[model samples]
Target: MEPTLPMPAAPSSIHFHANCTPTNYSTSPPNSWPPFPLAPAREISSYLNHSRHLSKSKPLPSLASSSQPRTLCFVAMEKKFVEEAGCCYYGGDVDVDGEGRATALRPAALSRPHTQAFHLAWLSLFACFFAAFAAPPILPALRPALVLSPSDSSAAAVASLAATLVGRLAMGPACDILGPRRASGAASLACALALALAAVFASSPRGFLALRFAAGLSLANFVANQHWMSRIFAPSAVGLANAVAAGWANVGSAAAQVVMPVAYDAVALRLGVPVTVAWRVTYLLPCALLVTTGLAVLAFPYDDLEGNRSAAAAAGGGNRSNTLWAVVRGGVGDYRAWVLGLTYGYCYGVELIMENVAAEFFGRRFRLPMEAAGAAAACFGAMNAAARPAGGVASDEVARRFGMRGRLWALWAVQTAGAALCVLVGRMGAAESPSLAATMAAMVACAAFVQAASGLTFGIVPFVSKRSLGVVSGMTASGGALGAIVTNRLFFSGSRYTVEEAISCTGITSLICTLPVALIYFPRQGGMFCGPSATVDDDDNDDGDVGANDDYMLLK
Candidate 1:
């Protein structure tokens, strides 16, 4: 007789076959059957009891079948969980995984390639300013060597600045069409070639002036530098990044003031070279540096205006014939861009004018030696290393605290203070016994505020229109140059107005410019003219509504 075995427990979700046949199972009840040979019925009953106890404890699924709906529901739930945990559904490309979130919130240190791009952009801008201001620092040497009278030298200096202004105006459209990498590289190369030619073959003052003017085109690299930084850094950090680039580059002018004279003296004394030849040779180093920087820009992979490796790659048609024209039109149509340009003109333009005239002002006012005055004047440009970056950092903090209003508020505060400082400096200069220390202090304060204002103005530039950033940057920079030119004409005009009067005039102009800045409005947070009605598409969407926000957002 067969032993009576206990039943084993099983999950309801699983089904098992109960057929008993020679090919399938033994001819006995499933719970009672034992495929393996048992010594006696007692052993089979004991085995069945142990199996039933184990099944009751675990209730494991049978090796038979599973529900299709349950399996598919589980799969769908797992997929949904993954997407919720790992995906960004708001059009951002950032992954939402643990590591991805960490990376997005606090990015890793700049990689080598990014670092290289930053350094190259900085060096290129520095070289441009270095070459542009090279002639000014050595103007004393050039005066006699090139047989330039005081008026002639001053006019030539202003001409170089004027040329830079024109270059900046054109650079906007060029940067948009050709892209910053190519535009920067080409401008740098042209500057180097011009400097080299001037150093080697410029015989007369006029010839040298012409070459220097040509070399001043390098100043257009300012636009390229800012554009590069805008692309490389996050929107929140772009203010500081642009300020650092601008500030470091502006240091080139001060460096030239200090280094060029020393280099000339070193070459003349150590090499026993003639003064004329030594002065000319002094340009070779900066020229070589400029050329090398240009080549580096060409070699490196960088983004164009549209954030592409190349302009052709960015555009499907591969034809940028109308790009320049469209950029200009778009830039001009945006009143906010022009207002910012005007604001920049007051701050940066004042800096440019003061940079060129500070030495003369100090020399004439304090009756100091040329060398001492030059050193004192250098203090203005040198302050850039600290002041410019500080401005940018401060602007970022203000934005964080106050949102869009904080940016404009910061701009207004600094410009107003700057205007006051300028007036104070003028008042001190006009006093009977002018205090050189006091005036220098005032000038330094004024420079800091002015440069800070420049940083603040640009902090809002990228928000104006992503597609027209290059054009906007170029136009605002050109405004600085134009301001300088107008100020220079007033200050340097045939001994008509004194330095104090000119300084006062600049202060008055800057104070007035702050009004427009205060009046400017934004439609959305972190956006100037970029609202739903004014959305700009990358594919040349030129509907009448493209810049419609500009009209309503300018003063609301």
Candidate 2:
């Protein structure tokens, strides 16, 4: 096929200040102002509908890019208002039209097109990665600090686990009701604050558990952030852009290998090992880092062209129950939502099971020290995190080369192969030295390859139904939760099976059952991820016109 075409260049080439001021600032002496390039096409087209609301009587705020700091330019398309043309590198003013948008302000100092959106999406994914690592590694450090026996610790931690499960379940509805952009920003902030507080006050399992629960709530960011990007970028760019984000997220997971160890050491030094200090510090530091990133999200800049579904549609929310039923009953009463959700869940389930249980498997089967085993365990989580983002980008390239449908099949084929390798690992566990080495190698390779599937699973979600991105996300996450818990719970086979054996078995099963589901759900001839050239409004109008102009209407 033709070389994968790059997404269109953003609206502006010149870097300029984009101060987002309400139409009528308190008539106060304006913060320092400067001159710059006019609005980029993105700045104009993204928000046509929102601009109408900006002013029914006045020409929408003149669009101009500013190089100097504190430069302000407002654009309103159909009354959806973005006072700033560019994105903010750091956090600043933000009043989202809905919960679906993960939009942020761009620092007037920076002018790379779609830079703000890309940066925020990456950070959001990073924050999600942060939580992913924190829970598993910090469990040990936290236990002594909380002064709980294993049983008590489990009880307290259960809430956090529940929070993630429930949060995933709830996230989609919130996004559908509120919108992806808004939901993501809110979830990110909520997570940051919860983690921060837990860090400072966590003396017992209960306190930290609460914090974990809060942090888990932010997992919504994974779904919402991707949706936010889909809103901002055209369909063609989404695959590559999301791949980068997902890959970097996994990188964050990989980095956590280093971070978690250092964090454990740092806290132990100050608070002493086997005490609560290390755990508190470990949890607390992420709070600061992630919150700071969340703030940056709040301060991210606008693309001027992208639009949100919720606020645009009267800021009215959806009936989550109905929406969810729709997904289960077949999306819009068809196969769209469940198929994608199942595929994503199946893939997510396989990867997370391995990452979540690796330490237990290795420590028990191989009899390694906790930390040593965990170090190896971190490899899988690290791989999964990095792979998701990179895979997203790779999927996009595949889509560009072969069509979006090809990306789906490609990811499925890879994940299936990885799962097959996992089976090989388990079977070889009781075999010769060659068997063990081969299995281990397979585990590592699958660890990395599976993420591409994960990335594609999520990257494709938003476009399935621009309006239902959140619900779609929630359903997929819900499926993920089921897959994660069910697959792992089977390991509870009281002395029935070894951990590695269980994992290997689940891996094979997921590939066997879910991979085909993905393929069948996304048939060969259909589109997987797509967005119209015009905004949702344009689509609505076109439909309306067709209805009005239908020749059959002559009788009416």
Candidate 3:
């Protein structure tokens, strides 16, 4: 007889089912993947037989409709990925004879929303980074009038921190119950009230403390803001949205630094309003903005996760009943969330100190009076406004080309360089009264790096979560709050005017700790770096819902 093909062992067991456990599936036609250009038509066409001619407008049959394993893989990849992955998951295994290749007999989850909620979430999250000025940077202008020491003025700082913690803890669960829409309204209402109260009761320290706490508690609007933004946009648009938000947040910070001071001076210089009265400007404007945002969102028609639904409808629409606790508990246990949170906290702590207490640091270190130092400190504050967007843009382009692997490494390297340079900026400005231009330039550079780092820090978040942007942001911001607590101590706030020591002590420390964190969390590349990227494939459905990558990326 002519040479015969070798026989291979059959599967331990086999059975045909009416439907897969998870859901129905359609018979995938040949060359089913769109464009037909990315993949050869013959390979897929042969697998589907003649079913490939179905019209594009026709509703796709569910995987549940298919009886064959190959058809189901093509039709129900999203649902079957995890829902059908039972412990005894395998139904069949292809064991090829000597020269033939083997293939898995089990279903696998599909990858979608590669950068979905991330970009949108980043913008809203970045806004918090900048909005912090209403609470922190503005507090200093009130000090001279309040007759409080610069160090003790941090009381408003501490209250806001505590309130922010409250807002975060509360808003997260609220997002689950109230939905993003309700939560945003409630949070903004609170924020507006808090700011108004602070401004109205400018003369009362006790009232001021209470309002500061309220403002912190009110910021929960931010979480809901992020969720809403993420829900509205598609995956591909995520990077750009986040980049813009990152830039705007710095703008908010810059506005706080530069504008608030001028406003304060307006009342003090023009109207004989002392620091307390001048500080009213800081408290009033945020209140107006909060109320306006709250009202506007309430009036608009809301749609969370409506984009690119045709590719994956089931995953795109938001579940009316999804809870925030589900998101938090699900992600808090995640290792990646914690690791990224660490990096955020470390770098953010430094940034917060610069934005909030730099006036004091500059005042004490150089013995410049409070207002002048506060004025000059705007250099960092202003640089941050422009630098953050640039960072986001840079990160976007880099990630698109080299993938997350190259982008993350670059982010850390830049941060490390910037932090080290802070030392130089400080040393140059320390002890000596250099030309005003040089001193301002150094301060601007420091600020630029600070804001630039702010943008870069958020750049990694897309790689962190697929389904749980709210939770991930919460964890990172919460950690950042804790970091703020540590750095806000009196010793760190000492207004000694030596630029070099402050830079070495503050700037360098932030760099050292965050660098390691950036390295650790960055997606691993080719065994060189280990990241969740291995688990997250490049298959964006453009839908709001996440698929398999949700599990791995959510926590770790």
Candidate 4:
């Protein structure tokens, strides 16, 4: 006497199979189908509507026994089907196209999370770069007030790089644990506070150096910035997106070089404020901007649109801490990561060294005024605007034709050319009668190549290991700091060499570092001169634990 529910026939495409066989079909009474428990009414309606659309005239077969088992089986199959075919966000499955990423980038589409994440990532790093480099442009004023010697200035640069190195190492694992959104935002806010303290309390050389070290922690945001882009964008567009974000952020350093000096001039000269007080006040601009953008990063976008780590418990059924340690170990153990780190050291490390010393170099060697020297230095960092993006775009373009090998070739070619240019610029400085115009011209070209090399270096980073993406990013970024520390300590610190001599030595080191690019090879993707293995396994997931739900999300 159990009442049965009438159901339309299932389409040929819908298959319902399970382990349990029905006990009785002919003996089952009419009007006796069991209702599916916990299935929402709207979902059942949707399924019926879909069934009706597939077949209008076919009469549906009755259930054997109005049993709960059969009803549950149908619901399970439906849930699985929706998960595979339907696009989802947050904890659900990602969009299906590019593995949870959009195929194209739309910078102007601020309403979308994909685009919003991109803007927040770059802007946060941009603010951090500004704060970290702000002091270099106004070093003339700072040195006089704080009684800092040339050695102390060099030590300050070393201190900052060392702090940044530690921070980068820690942030990589933190990004994997807490997500890039929290990791980057917290670092930015902390560095902003340090900048504020430096502006107010840094009256002596030691205090200035300590605060500079603290502020340098902001640069650790670079690891998260790259990690965020890699997670959000598809492999096809990831290179350009990473390059564009980092390149735009780097312009902040150039902006600091120019803006701080101009702001100092406006306050000290026009307003008749003391030079010391004007420089102190100038620090507030970057400090406030850092706080603003840091909060924006935390507030706006989803932690990761694909939620790769959201279901950490289910991936291999391992504990979260064990997984984290595994990823760190995997990233650290990889020889290729070390090679990329060394190569990154020369390109990005040289860029950092330039940001700290270029203004001083121009002022002392060329006899330019403070503002003019800062402006010239700004030119070097400014090349990042286009030069870096060109490197990334070139990597993506060549990659389409040549796979991973093409990316390696592009990086080697561009980086080698950049190293040669660095040597040329140093020789120009060593000229008996250095022509300012000609030197500036050569420096501009050198900047273009050097910045492009940075872009090209990252172009290969993402492919190294998807599972330890953040850790690899951190290792690579920290290497840049280590390179700066070594190069600065050896050539520039304690008046070990003339500025021109240091520049030449640094260029030579860069050339030596570029040789390692040949050693990096991917098993499935091939290498600089090798082809992929003939029996390649497409299901290889050796790098990291990518969630099944972490697929592409196409933006409308």
Instruction: Output the number of the TM-score-best candidate.
Output: 4
Candidate 3 structure quality by residue, lDDT tens digits, 1-556 = 1111111221212212222222223323234332111112122222323222322223334444344432122222211111111111111222111111111111121112212222333333333433456544455455555555544566777777767656765665455444566666656766677667666775656666666676666545555654444443333333444545545544555565655566666777898866655666646666666666666555433323222221112223355423444455555656766766666655555666666666656666567764576666666666654676666656566765665665566567666666666666666656456455675676666666655665665655644554556666667656666666665552355565333565566666667666555445433332116645566454542133344333222211
Off by over 4 Å in 3: 1-141, 176-181, 202-205, 217-222, 268-282, 307-324, 361-375, 434-436, 490-500, 518-556
Decoy 3 TM-score against native: 0.65
The most accurate candidate by lDDT is 4
Candidate 1, residue 89: CA error in Å? 22
Worst 10 residues of 3 by lDDT: 97-106
Error of 2 at 211 (Å): 4.8
lDDT of 2 by residue, 1-556 (tens): 1111112333443232233344331122233433233353334334322443443344323434433333222322112223444322211233222111223322231323355566767777677667655665556566666765644544443454456678776766665556655666677777777677766876776776676577656665666666556555455555655566656665665555457766777667755755545566566666666767777766654422333344223211343433444432333343566776666666766765666556656666677665676777777766755566666666666766666566667777767776776676677664534343465677788777667677777656645554454566667666665666666556534457666567677766767755454443332234435322332331242212112211111100
All-Cα superposition RMSD per candidate: 17.9, 11.0, 13.3, 10.2
Report lDDT per candidate: 0.67, 0.55, 0.50, 0.75
**TM-scores of the candidates in the order shown:** 0.74, 0.69, 0.65, 0.81
Write the number of the candidate with greater TM-score, choosing between 2 and 4: 4
